[model samples]
Target: MTRSAASVPTFPGSTILGQFARSLISLAKAFKDRREVRNLAEFDERMLKDIGLTRSDVTSALAEPIHHHPSWVLVRCVGRPAEAHKMTAAHKPRPVVPLASRV
Candidate 1:
């Protein structure tokens, strides 16, 4: 009786699957090299909007930057509360605009 040889998957001879694997590896490397954000204060409100977060999120983050795993700290930051002057209860007047003639 004759037995057939078994073939193992590998990168060789410009195969379609090999190309796809290479593409995936390249994408992974690119993502791994991406910049990391370690703090919320560095980002402005507009930048936060791009990533779907608000000001309150930043405030909370600064308050307590702790996380379950130490690795998580590489990209997260807990911001501290604003100074007393900023959070104090004070009223400011808004400018009134005159309406144009609409008779």
Candidate 2:
């Protein structure tokens, strides 16, 4: 390291770059949390107005595929309904012994 560069005061701790990166990550997470909080359409109308979003946006986002998920689930969404139908048919209960117990 240069002798002159070493003389600079470093806030008695970590660097501004490190601080900036940490702040950016923290901001990102905060936005993510806000998005999740907004997802719950259970919020009242006044609350929605305060957040500056409508119920439709939340409902529409719910329809969209989640960011991270199993690849097979994504395939299922893209593929023909025939596969889903067969899977459903195979799992369906017969009249004899149903998997669902009466509550």
Instruction: State how far residue 17 of model 2 sits from its true place (Å).
Output: 29
What TM-score against the true fold does each predicted structure earn? Answer: 0.27, 0.29
| lDDT computed for candidate 2 | 0.57
Which one is best on TM-score?
A: 2
- Global CA lDDT of candidate 1, please? 0.50
Tens digit per residue, CA lDDT, model 2, 1-103: 4579668777655677789888788667655644664455788777755655456555554555444222233234334355777999999997786578789
Best by lDDT: 2
Q: For candidate 1, list the clashing residue pairs, or say none.
A: 61-78, 61-79, 62-78, 62-79, 62-80, 63-79
Backbone clashes, candidate 1: 6
Model 2 RMSD in angstroms: 14.0
